[model samples]
Target chain A: MPREITAFSNPLVKRVQALREKRHRREEGLFLAEGLRILTEARETGRVPRFLFFAAASAAHPLVRALVHAVEAAGGEAVETTPAILSKLSGKDNPQAVVGVFDQFETRLDQLDRGAASIFLVAERLRDPGNLGTILRTGDAVGAGGLILVGDCVDPFSVEAVRASMGALFTVPIVRTGWEEFLAWLRGGPGQLVGLSLQTEHDYRAVAYAAPTFLLTGNEAQGLPDDYEAACDLLVKLPMLGKADSLNAAVATAVMAYEVLARHR
Target chain B: MPREITAFSNPLVKRVQALREKRHRREEGLFLAEGLRILTEARETGRVPRFLFFAAASAAHPLVRALVHAVEAAGGEAVETTPAILSKLSGKDNPQAVVGVFDQFETRLDQLDRGAASIFLVAERLRDPGNLGTILRTGDAVGAGGLILVGDCVDPFSVEAVRASMGALFTVPIVRTGWEEFLAWLRGGPGQLVGLSLQTEHDYRAVAYAAPTFLLTGNEAQGLPDDYEAACDLLVKLPMLGKADSLNAAVATAVMAYEVLARHR
Candidate 1:
């Protein structure tokens, strides 16, 4: 039987709650993935957490019961906890039956394989967490190699973003860097650096994306920095047939990513 | 000079607040559009509301000053009110400089022109307000004729959905009906009835959409009801390459919409 934790103030609970903060996540090198399906995805993707938790009342539920034993079998701690304790740690009025805590993972710019033979996404100064997460999901759906979070992009691991990603969070690798570093990484060696912009005269469909593609998208409000646009080998635009000037950032990125990847395939 | 509304409890304020609720919107036949760009789109698209309101301080802003004249010139009312009044009516701490309340426009299925010569979308039992709105935006981007809200979809005029739509609400025609009625309408007379489903073996791109297309999409979680799936003239699926079984509903719809429309154009 897994040990039951009733006290909300337990140190382990405090540590898990602290992981919600990005600074603490970075400092402790841990982040939380909640709900049963996502935790299962984490485990299946070989990104299982160091610790797992389940509400004591739900321990008998087949999936939770099975996951608990699996966690224990894999040398990770699995605890059964009271609803209040789980609620406090998960920051929900009613917490999920299960939660998993995994270490933050990233690939350094220098670590990217030059001839890896896969598409990658670069989001320039992206802000909306939902957009970032949807972009990640699109990247995964198209079998992109990874994502490069350029400049001050929103945190992809934020709860809202993770939920938007729908388990793609575990499957796709992400790299984060400032403008200078990203440009240097691009210059060194990779794939075709293409930018999607509204100001461009070229239609998106006109561009051939057969070469290993690095599809970069602009921020919602400001778009790609001028210097970064200069660095891109091609800049393309989606047609806007109506009064609205542009589609939502995530929608535009999805169109670009799917189109580019679809052509190459 | 437009009348000033300083008291939050004023009858007009109460009425405007009531518009936020679907029941009240249905009862009063009105909905709101906020923010500068969307309001501008509303004006340009000839969707200028019966009533437009501006915060008193911004009444002097060039765009607001111009819009005030344009509204009156176009036989509409424009009111200038205090910031608190605008904030309360708009339901935001920092509300947009202006807000417009327009009629809830819904065309009856029988009223649709028999050979209108345009594409249409059918969202079957979609629940997410954001997804519904994004679908509207995509529909507008592709010059779709209208949308059919079959079964129990979210209210398209709800604030969150309207924001997601990014002003496409004004340009697109919409019709609402029960599943049986929708089926009856689909069979009566329109165009090719195409359905998108993961269950289908056919790839979406391989299907030709050169004819007037009525694309039927399913709910985010449960997807199209099995009965509706049987009703589709043809079924196709988007390619999913990674572990995630599906893409966000709006993203998937956009991919399909762009692809079909691109082929025709």
Candidate 2:
């Protein structure tokens, strides 16, 4: 049954809004992604939106209408409401015309390595949701095997991460893992491990980046830990010139990923 | 004398909040930059704050007090407000402990030339403020001669840009110029011109960045303009192997900037 949720006080709306908080998202195993582009990409990937909301006034736009129709066609609920109500649900002062609450993807690390040479991303303690999402998009662009979320990193499925990913979230495979297990896996790996660290004296360009390399990065404020430094066969530092001392984690990861791609090509 | 702004409803507060809007920032030729780090960096460079605001309660942090004291010592009026009021006036949802307003610097094109050979960044219609700010920091790090803002671009002093730049705004000389003049300047060339484009068939490493070069770039969404391609003495492309078309503008710019620095050293 397609439910029409109108009130901002509605339970479904509450649940959707709750997904914005990290703890709530962790507890509920759900995340909300907004905007038409993300919704379209989600639909194309056979993702069934659990709940979809749109501004009734903007229901006339072809893109909006199409998104509503797609949601409906997928047997998901499509509800129309005032922009004011939508804005309230969306923590953002200016809400996108459309939003969707989608089920959290359950991906296993073991399942990701099935029948393929894997080139994965391991992010440790990344605090910024936007950086995580940007990395997801860049990973998708690079056709990475999957992403391994490690340490105290922000939830990859959070609203901010999803929005920043530009719909790449739906396409990219992500596996959240404990740091200890991640370290063990890297140590046990036949695959190459490339650790990105600002402290490393070695230049990034010096690394070969051959084989199925697991490109690892850490938090923006802090780079990878010393214990995990031994896990990598090579520790590479992005060439930097400023007093800021380092590039943003997402930017560094993207540059290294591109380098890997460049070498392989 | 510098003005001490205390009340949240003060016209100065309203103007500072309006800095979040691009239109307001451009129309007024002013922008707000927060945090002690940025304020201190600006002050160190002889930039006199037009106004300064700080938290009234919670004197636990020594750095906060030192920053406020520094501002007041420099003949700048420092107004203390409640944490709530400070948060409201800071523009960001979670405000930094301190906020300040400074006069918008008007940099002339001719001011870029300082003595002998020097590298400069020339950006055409760079839309993303975050990217522009990152580029500015990178330029400062490499000791670039200056920056030339070509074509229609975002104001470099916007709040987002300022935050991303990490106080590089006060140090870097910026010259905003038109396309025709930019082309003439590059072509007439006090030095060689190095252009970055995704479509360029030549590898970036192949280019000799020996001379005082104008490193030219375009927007994140689009590469350099087709007409300006001929004006560049050298066109170089970052090597890529991913499904993603190219690196983010800031990352790409940083890579090229560092590469030039490496070659120069």
Candidate 3:
């Protein structure tokens, strides 16, 4: 039996709660993974968890047991904690029964391409975590090349982002790069650059996506900056007939991703 | 001169803030509309605002003045409120400087079919306000017949819902009905029922979307309930090759809406 830690005042519990903040997560070189789905995805991605905590009562689920056994076999630590203790460590008002503390992995853009024509999502200064997470999930679903976070934006690995992703964080490769560096890399790189904007004269449906593409999208309120707009080989807009100036960032990205998929298929 | 109320304890200010909760909104028969874009859209839709509140600093914008003048012309009232009061009434910690209060209106589904094939959205128990609001905007944009809300879902006229709708609430017609009643109506009505689900056997691209159609979508967690599944005449699913089981409710709905537009065009 792995030792059970019941006290809320435990040092480990305090540390886990602190990891909810970006500063603390960076300092500790770790991030939190919630729910059975995220943990299973992380394990499958070969990202080992440093510690696994589960509610003693929830340890009976076959999948949970298998996950725990797998963690133990890999020389990682597993501990059973009471539901109360698990909630305290999670710092969430409604915490799931199982949580894992995993080491953070940095993803490089080159790692996302798998030899063929790849589709990469390049988000420029998107501030909403839910939007970014939904985009990431959509990217994962479409088997996109990877994600490049450009400009100052929300941290894609933040708690809200991770939760909204529905376990896509483990499956999609993501790289955060400055605007100058990213544009320079794209100009010299192996993909055709596609930009999404409301001011674009050409309809997205009209664009022919024949080559490996780098799709660039902007924030909901303010769109891409002028310099980045100038860098695109093509700027396309989703047809808008309603009162809204444009679709939400995530929806727009999905529409574009689906279009790319349709062309490829 | 519209009086400027500053105190957070002001009765009107407190009442406006309480509008954030459904019970309070019902008790007061009022909902909050923020941002200039939303207010402008509301006016364009012919819904007059009962009260228009704005920051003293922004009172100089030509569009802002036009909004104030339009409200007075329509036999309504306009007021200049302190930034602090605007913040309090806006519900958000940082509210848009301008906010408006309008009486909620109800529309019946039968009135929507006037010499044309109707195209509308049927939302079943959608809990997320953002999803519901986005769907309303999309529906209005596509010139849908009307929106029919079913099950015990979030009220479509809430503050968050209004914000998300981007002022489409003023233009779109909405009706609410019980689950069994809605399903029965779909069976008896003249329109064809189309549903978006991940579990469906066929891809969305495989379905033919004709007008006089009612698109039924469900809550984020579960797809449309089992009882209502058979009610739809056609079922469509977006292709998913990635790890995540689904797309965001609103995103998928938008995709489906666009597909309908494409088929009609």
Q: Which number leads on DockQ?
A: 1
lDDT of each: 0.82, 0.75, 0.80
Best by TM-score: 3
Docking class of 3: medium
TM-scores for all candidates: the values are 0.91, 0.82, 0.92
lDDT of 2 at B2: 30
How do the candidates rank by DockQ, highest first?
1, 3, 2
Ten contiguous residues with the weakest lDDT in model 1 chain A: A109-118
Worst 10 residues of 2 chain A by lDDT: A110-119
Put down candidate 1 lDDT per residue, A1-265, tens digits, no spaces.
Answer: 5777778778888888888788888788887888888888877887767788888788888878778877888788888888887777778897988888877888888877646646888888888888888888988898877888988888877766777888888988888998888877777774788898877898999867746789898898888878788888999988877666667788888888888877887
* Higher-ranked by TM-score: 1 or 2: 1
Query: Per model, how many backbone clashes are there?
Result: 0, 1, 0
The numbered model that scores best in lDDT is 1
What range of 10 consecutive residues in model 2 chain B has the weakest lDDT sum? B239-248
What is the per-residue lDDT of model 2 for residues B155-248, given as tens digits with 9 covering 90 to 100? 8988778888878887778889998976665555467778887767898777677568778888767788787887778899876444445556
lDDT of 3 by residue, A194-263 (tens): 9998777898777788567788998777888777788888898877766656577888888888778767
**Best to worst by lDDT, what's the order?**
1, 3, 2
Decide which is better by lDDT, 1 or 3. 1
